[model samples]
Target: MRIFDPHIHMTSRTTDDYGRMAAAGVRAVVEPAFWLGQPRTNPGSFTDYFDSLVGWEPFRAAQFGIRHFATIALNPKEANDPRCRPVLELIPRYLDKDSVVAVGEIGYDAMTPEEDEAFSVQLALAVEYELPALVHTPHRDKAQGVKRTLDVVRESGISSGRVVVDHLNEVTVGEVHDTGCWMGFSIYPDTKMSPPRMVEILRAHGLERVLVNSAADWGKSDPLLTRRTGEAMLEAGFSEDDVDRVLWRNPVEFYGQSGRLDLSETADTGPLFEGSSILRGGS
Candidate 1:
């Protein structure tokens, strides 16, 4: 089935990952602006990073026949850094770009005041821009964070349907699913949801606004997890249409709220750098 990973960090992955994703039937992906491990010291750093997401990364994905889209935001983790907080002012400009389908990976990280400010401001920007949001629920103290997250979202006046509460699990899914927002599951190898576990959630949740993503990055993650989850769904007695809805259609419906989700390929596509090769030599 054709798949769309609604959240991934293609900035940290190689061209090979794109090729593999294309091979595995991943036709489109959304890479959210996230903390790049090292603390960024200034807003200019965010500018450059955002440029690459809209510029270089999409070009790279196109070479592999995969459409690339991005979500722009000052990630919650970086909001706590005093020097990095100025990037919040830079976000509005990126939000106006065509490929920016959402204001995302934005939510509580440490549940700090700084994170709260960034989350609120960005959510407001999403409202002003008429864009959807991809909210990243905190990994630690997650249950508490999820409640605080939904509370803030309620106060933001942004429609819950326009918000996607990501990185959800069994414990948190019930609450997040209760909200009108879309639910996101980040499948990983040893931690977070596994492919089988994702199928289990689909069994329990019934796959309405559910989104499954690999969330692969510099960590020990698998970029093919979306494909694996689809395969598992088929194994778990999910029909082809069921797999299609969760893996592909769900992301489309959520991000399509932007009125900016472009899956069509442009003229700017074909082989790798300097005309090297991702193709095999012999038939």
Candidate 2:
């Protein structure tokens, strides 16, 4: 079955992961800007990271025949840092670029006042830029975090149809479901929702506005979990179309609001980016 991982971090992944994902039927992915494990020192650090998201990372994904797109934002964890705040100004320019499909990873880490301001401003940016948004709920106190998130989203004036509240689980799913915003679950190997758990969610919640992703990054995450979740759906007796709606069509409908998702056959990006290949000694 074809898949479109609506949220993943290929920037922290290896080329081998891309090859595996492509072989698993992942033809496209949207990598939202997020915190690196190491704290960034300044806006320039984010500038370089954003550049790579729109530049080097896409080039790398193309090598494995995956079409890559990005979301631009000052991630929630870094929004609290005074030095990284200027990256907000840099985001609008990137949002104007063709590869940027949304403004996101923009919600709460600690749910501090600083995070609140950043979240509101970036949601406003999404509204102004006419793009979709990807909201991240705080890992702790998640139910409350999602509650406050939907509150902020309501105040932001962006339509619920244009936003996705991600990293949701059984406890938090119903909260987002009634709000008319898309619900996103990150299928992880251990820490977050697992494949069988995600299948049960689909069974209970039905398929509309549900997006399943790997959210795989620089952690103990697996990039193939999206594929694994799809397999579990089939084993649970979900029709192929049911699997497609959650794993593919839902994301397409949400991000497609940006008018930037290009699922058109992955373009031929050739073998080299800036005269360098993803190889030692140019292979």
Best of the candidates, TM-score: 2
Tens digits of lDDT, candidate 2, 1-283: 7888999999999877877787778888999999999999998999899999999999888777788999999998999999889888888999998989999989998899999999999999999999999999999989889999999999999999999999999999997999999999999999889999999999999999999999999999999999899999999999998888888888888889999888786532332222235655476
Runs off by more than 4 Å, candidate 1:
266-283
Which residue pairs does candidate 2 place in steric collision?
A: none
Tell me the TM-score of each prediction against the true structure. Answer: 0.94, 0.95
Question: Against the true structure, whose lDDT is highest?
Answer: 2
Q: Rate residue 11 of model 2 by lDDT.
A: 91
Q: What is the model-wide C-alpha lDDT for candidate 1?
A: 0.89
**What value does the lDDT take at residue 139 in candidate 1?**
87
